[model samples]
Target: MDRITKLTSEKPVIIFSKSSCCMCHTIKTLFNGFGVNPNVHELDEIPGGREVEQALLRIGCNPSVPAVFIGGELVGGANEVMSLHLSRSLIPMLKKAGALWV
Candidate 1:
């Protein structure tokens, strides 16, 4: 939990992902499309990844991968992100987080 907080604190947008998760890929692509250069941590490829994943689970990420933090806050997974996008709230959130300028 503390580790997750530290990681997220360093960036405007952060994504905790698994290398082979398609949904993770989609979410990352979505952020990139919005011109938000999110800091991506591929949990499957990093040391202590499983522990980080467990921490994510404790924080209420069901599937665990693709956990997104915007301005150091959890914005949830693909579904929540897509919902925000469909509601036209995602762009404004990104802008407010300083992840996107336009």
Candidate 2:
């Protein structure tokens, strides 16, 4: 869970993911397209990915890939992330967190 600590208080956006999710890849591509430096924590790389397991316990979400958080607020799965991006809310949120300019 040390990596979890690194994630906490470190970035405005954090994406918890697995390698196989198309939505996860899309979200990463979306962030890149926006020039946002979203911190990605691949669950596969974490110890047992137990951190994701714990997050599921806390959030009550069933271990879905691409668990995204913004300013430490759990923003939910990929569709929600894409919705935010589509509505242009993601950029404002990033700006609020100093993760983006304007």
Winner by TM-score? 1
Clashing pairs in 1: none
Q: Which 10 successive residues of model 2 have the least lDDT summed? A: 55-64
**Candidate 2 clashing pairs, residues 3+ apart or interchain:** none
lDDT of each: 0.95, 0.76
lDDT of 2 at 64: 63
Clash statistics: count for each candidate: 0, 0
Query: Candidate 1: how many backbone clashes?
Result: 0
What global local distance difference test value does model 1 have?
A: 0.95
Off by over 4 Å in 1: none
| C-alpha RMSD (angstroms) for model 1 | 0.5
- What's the lDDT for residue 13 in model 2? 81
TM-score, each model? Answer: 0.98, 0.81
